[model samples]
Target: MPTLTALSPEILAKYQPVIGLEVHVQLLTESKAFCGCVNKYGGEPNTHTCPTCLGLPGALPVLNRKAVEFAVLAAKAIHCEIRETSIFARKNYFYPDNPKGYQISQFDKPIAEGGWLEVPTAEGGTKRIGVTRLHMEEDAGKSVHDGFMDSVNRTYIDLNRCGTPLVEIVSEPDLRTADEVFEYLTKLKEILLYTGVSDCNMEEGSLRCDANVSVMLKGAKEYGTKAEVKNVNSFRYIRSAVEYEIERQIGVIEDGGRVVQESRLWNQGEGRTYSMRSKEQAHDYRYFPEPDLPPLVVGAEWQAEILKDLPELPEARRARMEAEYGITPQDAMTFTATRAFADQFEAAAKKAKSPRRVAALLTSEITMRVRAAGIEMEASPVSMDGLVLAADLAESGELSSKMLKQLLDTAFANGEDFLAVYEREKPQQISDTGAIEAMIDEVIAANPKQVEQYKGGKKTVAAFFVGQVMKASKGQANPAVLNQLVAAKLDQA
Candidate 1:
């Protein structure tokens, strides 16, 4: 086993960390990638499979047009250069889950390449990670193992996910830290969700990531031995796996041990990587063209049509929202993280008449209330129109910040309109100076000591007088009007 040493500034200055990522995003098509069987997961064992996906003899594979279009859209969103023509090749391998003894995937000519995605760093800056290639492939069946039987082992196979369309996006080694990996995944997931290409939900296994991590002498010209961490399902796991692997490699070098090139599985429970098997080089897979399926030819007209349907992506939306709404970049990023959230924000802003105010409310008060109610932005009872009404009341001086919060709570809980609830509550404001003056006189006459204290230069006692007058009015008095009346009466004294 190889041991690593902690690199000091002197050693660090001679080394660099090179990282590359392979992301598998399952497309949201209605059918399988190469067959007409429904492309679903978690069904009964072998229920979703057909002759083609099962690799039965004489069963032929057919391409899904929608899947192809989705791949094209995804490539365009990432700013990849789409080729006028691309081909699919058969990657031959033997495994229990691979019934066909081969997997159909892109080998030489992939769909997209040479793209760039900008990720944020912990230091409040952005790093652009270059994308090397984006290719499509078919998924394999899942295998289930049971140890209940002592004598005979039980093994079950589910083919529901088999033949499902997948796009494997390979990135160049541009990331330097664990934070960069997290940011890259975050930005990538956001774009995929916004484009409607995939749900990108890791919990459901719709999206997955594999990282190639290696470290070398700080300024070394060549790279060190690399380890591939497979199937990191969550963002937290990605960070942990990468950090652990970096340290592990460094320890190997420090102890003068050679780091083996192999594939490792992330044992989340143990918080370490365990060796799975030796990693295979490209030639080991023995790639060859599939005689069954013809080359995929994407013409200029088809690519152009898909390009026209692409919507405004997250980065552009964030920039526009920050510039136009006068919100901070962080706030703008939050608002536009999801398409539905961005749409809701814009609609509410138009009605609220104050984009900045609406942004603040959504990001803070409304968000807190919604989370407490166990609702997401899409399912929240507070609609854009309802928020607009609340903003209107606050802007017109009809409600204070405190009152507005109350109104929002009630509105979100019962789906009641803001004005209707305000009417029922009938929170009153002291608009009449005469009425306010009368209330102030009664308080002053009742509390002579406090009144004398105010006259003797204790200005802080003004708040006490305001509280008394507000309390006497049952807390319905308008604070602005009460302040004016209190000041005028004090001046006379």
Candidate 2:
């Protein structure tokens, strides 16, 4: 086998890569999907298992109503059509962590089907990617491979994640490029997070993605064999893995070789993917309806009740916030990155004198300070009430830009809210025009050379006088009033 190098643009453009993603999102339920065992992450091994999850004889499986509601909410977020009835099947598989020997999942009939997400394309357009289905299922336990006696040779099974409620979202083969896949997954994750169905913490495994990638001639009607890429922990790495897979497949075909269907693991350390095992087909799982559990039903009435809990999604909320608050699209995106953040901004903006000022403070001052401190926005020293006060002062000209920045710096430095620092510092701006004119007169007398330059068609030199006057006022000069006074005084000089 020849070593694979980067393919040229012409060779790459000759083939189209078809990508489909399967995302498994763990719901924020209190208990396991079929049992009453706690569904929290990170506990002692096998401590969260029950008879049903452990697959003990005579143990019967029970459906969790909350999980169903959450699954339906997630499905609706992606615009899927909710089915009246869906069946749970026994997907037979053998693994060290799957104590049940057969995993219970939805097959044939799923809870929802046929949805689409409109993602931004690289060409500055939106493309709709179809979602094949969103089905309810349970997660298998984890197998820890190291950090124990004989760690390298022996594997440890932890069933803490066993039977956790999950909703698997499968996307259609509509992605043509790695960038498209990244955009699609990003939009999907945003929608899921906004719905509050799952935390979508890729590191904690609350959300996981497996991508199926294949490449064929641009005009070919049939798709080439696809290799499923798994174990990619982040969206960025997923994009890289798909890129490498596309090129590798193309390279093989260019060398008169065929692409094989297999399961591959992305080695983030090596920046490439390696074959894991042969890909399993639907028949390999031998899925059959579970004898213990009956068909799950989510009627229209139940769905309507669940729909009430669905908050405004990201895209719609971003547009509405942009219009209502007169914020830029970028600011709207920043504010609405999470529902809680958007709610906080809206509540504060309503009370503030100027919503735009509030937007400016959030995107510039507060965000920068919070990031610098390496703390979450919620943990910022400045609260929403504090923001309202600051914005009000700035809008009413009670606080100049310099004053606000200094006050914000003081607040962050002292670990206090903006109101506390403002009240303590009592830094009042020199808005009195008579006083400003007096200072401007002093600045003009001192900078006679610059003053002459200002009068000699060098009007831009007026900034020198403004700076001198602001210094004379000890950085307390009202910028708007100071600018007017300085320009008028310089022209007179």
Candidate 3:
């Protein structure tokens, strides 16, 4: 086992790690890529298979129109140029899970090409990672090995996942570090979700990543032999794997051994990349045009139709949210992390008169509640309309800041909307001048020492009086009114 070490800055400055990620995103479509079988996850083994997906004797394949649309939408989401004509080829490989003996995928002609995903860097700027191509393919089924380790036993094959639509996004070798690769994946997943194309769930195998990593001497034009790391289900694990690979390759070169091009699996338990097999070149697969399917021709009209439905991507939406809601970049990024979050925030923010305050509350209070409850933003019990009402009540002196927070707490605790909880609680703010004056009077009488301190040039002690009055009124006291009342009462004392 290779022990993980912190590479010193001096060591890091001597070599460069060139990284690129090939991410496979399973499109969320109603049907499979080439068959009418349900494109879904988690069913009995081989239950979702069909003759076409199983490669029967005479079952011809037909392409799914929706899958193509989703591929185009995904490609456009990443700023890729849509190719007018693309070809589906047979990626020939032998695997028990592949019933067809080949995967229907695109080769020289892909669906889209030449796009870039801008990842936010730690230096408060963006680095654009080039996307080489985005192509469509069918996913293979999974092999469930049932026998114990080091024993001969039968292996079960589940074809439920076969023929599922997938869009493989290939990126240029522009990522220089594991952190860069992580940022690129994060931003790419966000864009994919925004377009409503892929769920990007790593656990269900809907989203997967294979990273090609190599280390070269600083300022060297020639590249090092790259190792492909797979079986990384999460972004963090992939980053760790890449970091370990870079270090291992550098160590090998240091010991006068050349790096080898190979495919490796990420040992998440051991935190290392172990070789699986020698990486195969393009010719090894012996690719050929998929005869059953015709050339996929996306015309101008089709492009217009698909482009019209493409949602506002992450970059443009982030900028618009910052400008429209008057929120800071951090707030904008948090609110627009996903399409659902952005939609919910925008809906509530637009309705509230104080958009900035609404943005703050959502990013702070609302997001915290949603995360703690383990519910998605769009599925929050507090609806956008309910949030708007809360914001309105807070801004118009109907509820104090503390009261507003209390109301949201009640809403979240009871798993009810703001209106529902507010109606039941009917919490009122003590904005009445005479009522507030009486409370302030009682507080001043109770805290005479603090009062005397305030009168003796301790102006800061006014906040003490405000807290007492707020406590007396059970936090429903209007903060602004209570503050004024406390200052006036202390000034007189």
Candidate 2 off by > 4 Å: 147-152, 280-283, 446-448
Candidate 3: tens digits of C-alpha lDDT, residues 1-493:
2233645567767898999889999999999999999998998889998899999889999999999999999988888999999999999999999988999999999999999988878887888999999999999999987778767887898999999999999999999988899989988888888889889999999899999999999989998899989889999999899988998888787667888899999998987888898865544888999999999999999999988989988779889888888899888888887787788788888789899878777778888999998988777888888888887888799898888888899888988999899999888888899998998888888888998888789899898888888888899888987887778777777
lDDT of 1 by residue, 321-348 (tens): 8888888898988888789889888777
Per model, how many backbone clashes are there?
Answer: 15, 0, 0
In order, what lDDT does every prediction score? 0.84, 0.91, 0.89
Best by TM-score: 2
Off by over 4 Å in 3: 1-9, 280-283, 367-380, 438-452, 471-477, 489-493
Give lDDT tens digits, candidate 2, residues 246-271: 99999999889988889999999998
What is the TM-score of each predicted model, taking all chains together? Answer: 0.91, 0.95, 0.91
Sort every candidate by lDDT, greatest first: 2, 3, 1
Q: Please give the lDDT score at residue 489 for candidate 3.
A: 72
**Cα RMSDs, all models:** 2.6, 2.0, 2.7
Lowest summed lDDT across 10 adjacent residues in model 3 is found at: 1-10
Clashes in candidate 2: how many? 0
